[model samples]
Target: MSENFDLIAVSPHPDDAEIGCGGTLALLSEMGYRIAIVDLTNGEPTPFNDDPQVRLNEASKAAKILGIERVTLDLPNRKLLDSIEARMILAKELRRMRPKIVIGMQGMTPRASPDHYQSQLIFDAAVFYSRLSKWEDIFDGLEPWRIENVFYYYTARELLTQSQPLQFTVDISTHFETKKSALLAYKSQFRAHPSYNPPIIDWIEGMGRYFGSLTGCKYAEIFYGSNIMTMNLFKHILD
Candidate 1:
């Protein structure tokens, strides 16, 4: 409906995208993709932060560090829901941006904010609502734009599920430091207190290396999708 983006990563909150798939975003940006991150909420009223604008400023800095565009929606932060209103609001953004691919924050983080799960539902519904036929009135008269690919990125603390969908890995060995820098940009979330920040940063490193080992790489991020991916293995295997 408006500017076209090659890829869009939908985050439930400001730092969600960075923690989930920042390295992939950096890699994609370096490979010349027009990428944008759409944050469903500005992530406010946290234990560490009192001002909501600080979260927005941090998101902007993270986006800059990753070398990508960022957008913050007016949706509720902690109390986010997958209601019809939320669906329409996110669908409007999808219609406006018209991205070919969308990577959504996936899985339920019960130990963390429940907004993560609701955000996943909202992301799923909005992607469907965005491509509906003759629903121009619902989407502010914007034309229906079908997203070609929909994938999900794992969150920080997600519930383990036996029904995990088809999964793949994106090698981020080269851009992993960029990802760390982007995530660290959110100082409010990763403050340099004696007990808070160090372990989290170490976890990030361990997680990336673990996932990368799955694909025989030094560092990588995992992605999940409902659709079957077609690929020729011979093309990637260099003797």
Candidate 2:
């Protein structure tokens, strides 16, 4: 599996990438870019699910719906940490995949699992480690690969107005249903109990519409990046 990817989204859990950026990923996949999701953990031991494999099944279904691939690491769920081990594992995957663009979940969710925050830290380091030349010996002899960009996606856990200076929204009006269907595949999570999940559908739709309004689209997904964007011409910006 030494093939390269156009984009790889790193997530703390299975349903995270779906919730945060499935629409945008689906759109990119439809555009003929090879997209994949690298799940840091399988997101097991939740109150709703018993079998660990169930999450993987749901994650696969979601990936199929998005037309992308899924890779789950054997990292600790719920107890995930941003340690050197975690960084190295993810960096090795990044080197193997050689994705041009890397996406990760952003923001801290104190009310939710602590893995979200640590996942961000791990992602930050993994992207950095993936580009380190001399450290290839530690990664099973995989060659160093420099990712062109690192972007971040977020869910309702973060504020509506992102503080990041380099932020933009992707129009997902045509793929909004695709995103919703992918999220719904996780029956063990959203449909575990109607009262357990916080109206996830509404939350998704609201965020989509809110960002869409900002970008003059029907539905959208916002992303934050570390790079400063440059426009070559006004026509591209106008379009």
Candidate 3:
């Protein structure tokens, strides 16, 4: 949590990170970005397991599969509140990571889960954390970290709204298997989800194809971001 993370992906649960941005993470790691993942909860009380330690172990394995540092905030399962204390805890971690770019669940489409609301609250807090001077003693001398970009990842939402794409969609056809392998590492989640019936690998491949069709690729992963995303056009230079 203390290192300067070049890319930070926050998830409401263990597998949410991999499901939402696994391919993107692989692409980013290949491009040489130091990536980190933050899991807000242990994802307990699911049919997969009743023990918190079991879920944590699965998350650890998933992180290893994805090849990124992982941190868990240990928030309660199914019940999360965006209190000042919670915000401060998040701020402390953000300060520790010192990430240049922050990505989190949009939680925009599904307004049902408290975890979703918590994710949004974390996203908002991290965005403005560095600006405020008033904070706990933990943030005493921590310099304000103004992340260059904030990307809202689409997950649960079936329809993508019309908006400018800040991040280029990467064709994940080559890495589709790898992405699935990483996601399946979270045994607690995919084990129970009926949608993942046939096989996780097959499921991801189909998903990649569906998303890739948007950009003329056989398989692709999309991202929304904003940090000088525009490209310069020239006859000789490629965009």
Cα lDDT listed for each candidate: 0.84, 0.88, 0.69
Per-residue lDDT of model 3, residues 52-98, tens digit only: 78788878887777777789997776887677667766777778788
Report how far off residue 219 is in candidate 2 (Å).
0.6
* Residue 29 C-alpha lDDT in model 3: 68
| Superposition error at 69 for model 3 (Å) | 0.9
Stretches of candidate 3 above 4 Å error?
109-112, 134-140, 158-168, 192-203, 226-239
- TM-scores, all models, native as reference: 0.92, 0.94, 0.82
Q: What lDDT tens digits, residue by residue, belong to model 2 across residues 33-148?
A: 88899999999988989999998999999999999998999999989999999999999999999988888999788788999989999999999999999886899999999986
lDDT string, candidate 1, 43-106, tens digits: 8877777888887888899999998999999899889999999999989999999887899988
Which 10-residue window in model 2 sums to the lowest lDDT? Answer: 230-239
In model 1, which range of ten residues has the least summed lDDT? 230-239
Spell out the clash pairs found in candidate 3: none
TM accuracy, model 2: 0.94
